[model samples]
Target: MENRPDKTNKNNRTMKEKIRFYIILTLILVTGILIIQTILKPIPQGITGVQTLETGKQQSTQNSITGLGFLQPQDIHQIDTCIGDLSSTGAINPGDTVELKQDIYVGSTDCLNIDIANITLDCKHHKIIGNSSSSANGIVSNKTNDATVKGIIRNCHFYNFTNKTSIYTGKPIVLKEGAKYFLIHNNTFNVTRGITLNKTIDVTIANNTFANYSTLLTLYTDAEIYINGNLTNQTNETTIYNNTFEGIGISTNKPYAIYAIYANDLTIQGNTILTSNQITLDGVHDFYLKENALSRVEIKSQSSNTTAGRIERNTYIDTSTAMHFTSFSPNELSNISIYKHDMVNFSLSTMGSGVEQIKIYNNTFAGPMSIDLGSANNCTIWNNTFYPDEQTQITTGPNSKVRNNRIQNGIFKTITVTGDNTTVENNIFTKITGRGIVVKANNATVRNNTFNNITGIAIIIGDDTWQPPSHPVNVNGTTVYNNTIYLWVNLTTNTTMHSLLTGLPAIPGASTGIMIMPNTNNTNISENNINEQNIYAQTPPNMLKAETRGIFGKGINATYTLENLWIHDNTINTIREGITVENCQTTHIWNNNITKAGKTGIKTENCRGTRVNNNILEGGTYSPNIILWYKTGIEIFKSRAEIIQNNKIDKYHTGVYIYNATNTTSINSTINQTQIGIFSFLSMNNKILNSTITTRHIGINLLKTNHTQVNNSNIRNETGYLNTTGIQLSLSFY
Candidate 1:
């Protein structure tokens, strides 16, 4: 059996070994060829294409892709190639085209399956009519993990995808599972639904028209261009430009024009959109919206990530809101800039607690426009013009700033700041009929503002009446500085009878320039210039006259004794009192120059520890002959612990009338051209020390007073009036 090891078996074994070796060699050669082919093949980058012009000549094209808010266009290589026409539904390969010759009716299946990459489907303006199939679509591109499909859909019309029988997902075109670099241009959609993009990237929908017909009963809640994304594959770099969306024959419950969810980096520019609803961005980031004429825009994000964007050069017409922002968490929507927008019949609002750092500038809001910052923090509004038909209202939240704005015409009612640490500066309010700025917050500052021809009060701090402790009183640390107010009534149009009939005050600045209410502590009013002209040719009969003040402070029914008030360095030319403090404590009025004071320059009633020092008061032809006895320099009525020092008063009936006041001191003061200087009536412990009183009548007149001392003073009748006495005492104890 060991003889030569069976020669036939050996020969068969050798043949088997050779066959195995040849098979292995063939596989190796095939694999080597495939590897070489893969290495030498060109890698496809972004959209590279050649566009044919009207002359039928091809040219290389590099198109710009739109991005998220306020971004410029980015150029990329693009391709636009067309193959022969095919009229049926089938799979399309790379470099293949499906061009429709006539209208095709789709039933239960998709018209074209774009499973492969780099394909074009042109319908040549023919319609793809869907007949009530829930899943039927005109074109479908479905890709998987790590795979991309590039598609172009142009010159097509989609109709009747209403899905009346079942759930309505029967869109015209559906791109899913990471479809990238798609260009959809020159298309028309007339259906209840439009195109849908799921998990797509680098897609642009331009030069298209989307409309709803009369046969459409209700539009779907999804937008015309509905974009959706997930956590892993976010929809990025999508642009909708040069498009037209018309919600024809639809009024109520109108769908959105473009609604994106969980998307990133979007550009919506150069589109004319007319819809009753909104263009919503939900959970989106990095958006640029410019040069678009639309109805409304809403940015709402509930995700943990930040939503930041820019909206500029846009026009919104016939809508209730031009822009609205909403968020769920703290600081979720931030760093949004809005500028250069023209809105008609629109409003801007931030209706979220999580919005911050918003900047709005260089915008024009015409007629019936308002701004409401609801619970948003750190917002800024500047350099805008507001022209309202009836009223203009602006409201802000905490740490907000409003500056350099022109609020003119219409009512111009109020700018309400309802939060702490807010600033309103450099704003111009002209031709207004109501109050200018109302600050209901702590640490608020109103500075460098101009109020011209305002018929009502300029600034109001804190509440006029008493409120509960739950809603605590604000304006504790408020400051009003460097503001100019010019108030006048038009005598040519308004009569004193009309003013009296309308309950208007007889004196100018009757509503006051700056009004301080009760419980307003630590308030500073300085460096303000207020001029009010109450010039009338004739006086109305039986009209009630009231004292109007430039800076007025008062207490209400429940709360009294306003403390720590500092009013200094103010120039007031009004028809009544310059500074008045009633039922207040620790009030300071210094360095104030007051002219044309009809009644009193500085009046303090029921006040304690009030100091009026270094003030110049001049009554310039303001005393009417009927009410000449009502004019005075410093009237301290029912007040105690008052100090009137270093004051210059001239042309008044009485210089310092301390009536029913106690513990008062008038020191180092000068009074000239007055009827009675330092008239103390029914007062106790009053001292007139080291003062000069040069008057036409009595200098120091005391009636029914006790412990009154006039020491180190010069009292003279410089006017040489008849029966003028230097010191006249009647029923007094000294």
Candidate 2:
């Protein structure tokens, strides 16, 4: 502005001065924008520091630099790339090496053609790496074998850019077989291809960045192939390495890392892959994947994939398990040798899931609540350490042989029943929070097992703690037998939480020790030592469910029946309910020690044809156990005919209460308790015979019941609820 050039004086300056001014202005504006944007869109505060970038430069040139229509013939006479004319360079002769200088611009239809032989039109490779300023690309040489040129061109960038052409087809720097020893090295390829070695061999394409090229690969599309799958013969001994791939073709797809079809003597190592898709595809024939550490590598299977490749000692770490692999066709046409590996460890404390074929023989685990397993094949587990965090360890589907395993400081429960026909024999299951063995499966043999320091809520009243969810996902028939279970609910809900303890009664954690829903039937229990007071202090016994609702709304009086149930030989030290048969038919309960009961021994509501016989009923002497017959005239939601036979009953309060179940038959069972021995309210068709009774109250009292036969039975009391009469006869049943 100070000394503005006059209109006439501006003509004195040379044209070079104007061009230099424009270039300087462009650089100034770029520098200003870089400074302003750097402030306005400030750099992000990463964990460490800002990432550093690397940079380099390259220059390319070709022969025949000068044209035939040169205004000054002498200034641009030489064939050096220093000349700048192509159309007028005249035809190339045999043995002529065409050198492409740094500035050789070709128009859309303009191509360098050669009809001569023994010519070398080469592109000496120059690299524009990912560490370069932005995504950079350079040059391409398509058809140069038969003549016009011979010689190498180095340091020319190769990229599929459209500085001149506007077509959507990406620009490619090609090299056909006619070109040999085409030393193409040190080039950066991003969003473009460097040199597609088609029908070419002995090519060296190294130290290049094929960056973000395989971007549009789809489920059915196989893009980003460095060379054609069928053209491996072109680059038989090719070498590709030290490249970082971060395109969609690299995402979750493991086959795009390094692909060499039928290629020989290939080596790939030291590559880092960080794709959101967790996998990269790498294919090689007799290939080597050594030191090629991957976040995730996917091995693919081809239609005619029969060659067994080698996979040796590659470390893979996946945090989210997003890393995946596909069988090389079928079952991988190969086997991999992993010297050492690690599965990402996390807290697996959540319980009650359905898993499969997981063998936990003799290993220390962090936390896995419910793990299902298949039949063990020649696998034996002995002397291992187990620590539980949930109420149950395993739920279903396995045949695990666990013997002599050291279980220490566990929580909730050690194992649970989830699947069908499994065997758990001779395992020490002791922990705090839940019962040692919680049965929820069918045909399960639980024998020779010891349980200590278990987790049970209370003793006096059952079901005082938290109950199970009403809606069960997968619950079926189960058999419980011959295992010592020591429960200590006083510790806490489970092992995960030790400071906060739930001191409720009635074995709080799960709804019922064994819940039988509609889909669950034909269940049996025998010979298991289940102690519940070690967990909860002075806990009450629960007769049925801790808290019943919904499907439990159908709990004791459910319309659905649990058929073919056999409850026998179970030593119930303290529990909510011993033999609770609800909506079941033809249930047989026999020879179970209902001593030291928590709430009650046997409870049957809406049950039909139940036979209970031959059991020692002792120190339940403190609690008044009731056997209420909730039978109705209607067949639906009603119970029928229950027989209590030949058992030494010793308890407090009372013996059996038959209510509404009119046709119940009680025979051959001894009774000795505090209050009444046998009391009936609207019960009928019962036979009381050959049984001794000793109690503080009535011997036999019938209130609104009939059709019973009493013979060969010794009964002595203070007139047996004399209010009813000396020999009472009532008609409640027709």
Give the top-scoring candidate (TM-score): 1
lDDT, model 2, position 124: 42
- Tens digits of lDDT, candidate 1, 1-734: 57676888899999999999999999999999989988985543432232222221222222222331111112222222221122122223354554565777776767665665655666778888876645777777766563446667788898887754455657788878667788888999887667788878888889999896533334434467888886667788888889988874364554577888778899999998876656887778888999998878887766444467899998886567777888776437887889898776667788778888888999887777778887778999999987775677788889999999998774645588877899999999887665688787889999999988766667878763334443436468999999998765443332332233123444432346787877778999999998764532112321124334578777543355578899999998854667888888889999999987767888998898999999999976433345567678989988899999999999888899999999999999899888888899889998889889888778889999889888998888865466677888899986
Model 1 spans > 4 angstroms off: 1-91, 146-148, 164-167, 213-221, 248-251, 304-306, 410-412, 464-472, 490-511, 533-548, 557-561, 621-626, 704-709
Evaluate residue 232 in candidate 2 and report its C-alpha lDDT on the 0 to 100 scale.
37
Separately for all candidates shown, the number of backbone clashes (residues 3 or more apart, or on different chains) is 12, 84
Q: After superposition, how far is residue 297 of candidate 2 from its true place, in Å?
A: 8.6
In order, the Cα lDDT scores of the candidates are: 0.74, 0.44
Residue-level lDDT for 272 in candidate 2: 49
Model 1's alpha-carbon lDDT is 0.74
